[model samples]
Target: MADQDPPKKPSSGLRPIERLNSEERLSRLTPATATATHHEYCSKFARDFLDAHFYYCSSKFVVARGGKVKALDEAFREAESWFSKALDWIAATEKIEIPLFYESREVQVSHSFAGRLLRLLMQYDRIFAETLYSLNCGSITADSRETTTVIAAKRIKSIQQLCIPDTDKFAPDGTLLNSSRSQTHGHA
Candidate 1:
């Protein structure tokens, strides 16, 4: 009989374990953690409220000074209520800590991360409330627009400081900071 190559064995209907193994390997290699996407989204929403408030403040200042006091007052009042809603949302979100699933990491790191995020969110909320309160009392006079502007600037600065100190905690992927910086810097 002529020599012939041995027939290849058919694959065992079992989908190759390699795929499962690879997935398992990837999961293991990457830290097994649940992300705080909800918290982040809420924070971003709060920030947006602040942005809107600032825009309203500037426009109101200009319009009010231009003697359109009625329209400016209306816009300011609207901004104030919007800020209040944002503050409430942030407070509610901070009350809940969405746990991340990590593979046996030290509790301190996890706690620290949660703590920092909570603190930053709270700080932003407080600042928003304070700004609104000041605006409501007419603390920012039309003549002292510079002073009011300074106050607004300080509140924003404080928020930036809080956010920058622990970027990793609040924004592990740097997406938030990057987007904000790019937008602000581009305008500048």
Candidate 2:
């Protein structure tokens, strides 16, 4: 018979067995061997305290900074490999030219996809809360956040920053706050 092309291998979507298996043989654990895994005997709370705290702090800080909130940084880190495939993803850069509070002055805010999440926090950025602007504390970062982890022992040099006071925080009736001020919160 004339030479014919061999049948093509069926495309079974999987990695080669040898490539997936460990190159080196794994050694069995012996009495002397100490594995990195440890069984800590503590209350379930103490065991997960750090992780819980991290999630809380990360989410709170992210929202306060007007950034998109992720479900969990740990989960994000874990799934990054699997979810990084940009098969259906678009790498297009998008931006919205909206005036935001940078240094008490209205500056055009532009960033890579900042319009998606940053807009939540940026919406409230205004000196006067006459309209939808709820009036918010200025983005004030101190040179020495001594109370925080920034300061080792002594206070470092601080930045001389300023913010335009939110005038809408006051009641239009010209009286002390008698109603709820939950919606209109500012660090003035």
Candidate 3:
């Protein structure tokens, strides 16, 4: 028999601990473009989290225990907090002014550095939605009265088609008469 070659082991460079520490320190340093980066990260995370959560709650949680439900709820809450903080960070960095209108009085609301950074993240979400629509990516239902009416009409037609007449008891002339033909035809 031929000697089989040893299976190649996947390499994790010798000093992983040192590499990890360096990477951690690099992430901690606030970059000159930190606001843009933070916004992008937060927005992407929020979008992914929302999509996953929707799928899980809609189909995966039907028979979940209380503990599982609680865990998922906590995770969702955390995601929301992250999203809010990202938005705050973006707003703060950009200094985008939001004018508040109350009782016909215009009030200028100033954003902090964090808020500006977070707002940049939101741009990704807007772009995501636009891309999905432009690509005709998923099932998009119309929320219109006309669509509802059409659906209702079809349902009514289906129900009418399903109804069976008692042919055994009623004659074509509308008389309550028992006949062998009526029994066979199911028109009573």
Count of residue pairs whose backbone atoms collide, per candidate: 0, 0, 30
Q: Model 2 off-target regions past 4 Å?
A: 1-113, 126-128, 131-188
Write the residue-wise lDDT of candidate 2 on 1-188 in tens digits: 46988889888877565411121211111212212211221222222322222122222222221111222222233333222221112112122233433332121112211221122122112111111111122222222121221221111101000001122322443222323565577433
Provide the lDDT at 98 for model 2. 39
Tens-digit lDDT track for model 3 on 110-183? 21222322232243353333333423433323342234324333332222221122333434443444436878
State the TM-score for model 1.
Answer: 0.24
lDDT of 1 by residue, 1-188 (tens): 46988887787766544432122332343334312222321234345433333222222222222223333234334444544564554343322233322221111112222333333434454544444444445654344433433443444443333333222333332223343566766875
Give every collision pair in model 1: none
Model 3 weakest 10-residue run by lDDT: 102-111
Runs in model 1 lying further than 4 Å from the true structure: 1-114, 141-188
**Candidate 3 wrong stretches, greater than 4 Å:** 1-57, 95-188
What TM-score does each of the candidates earn?
Answer: 0.24, 0.13, 0.24
TM-score, ranked from best to worst: 3, 1, 2
Weakest 10 consecutive residues of candidate 2 by summed lDDT: 154-163
Following a full C-alpha superposition, what root-mean-square deviation does model 2 have from the true structure? Answer: 26.9
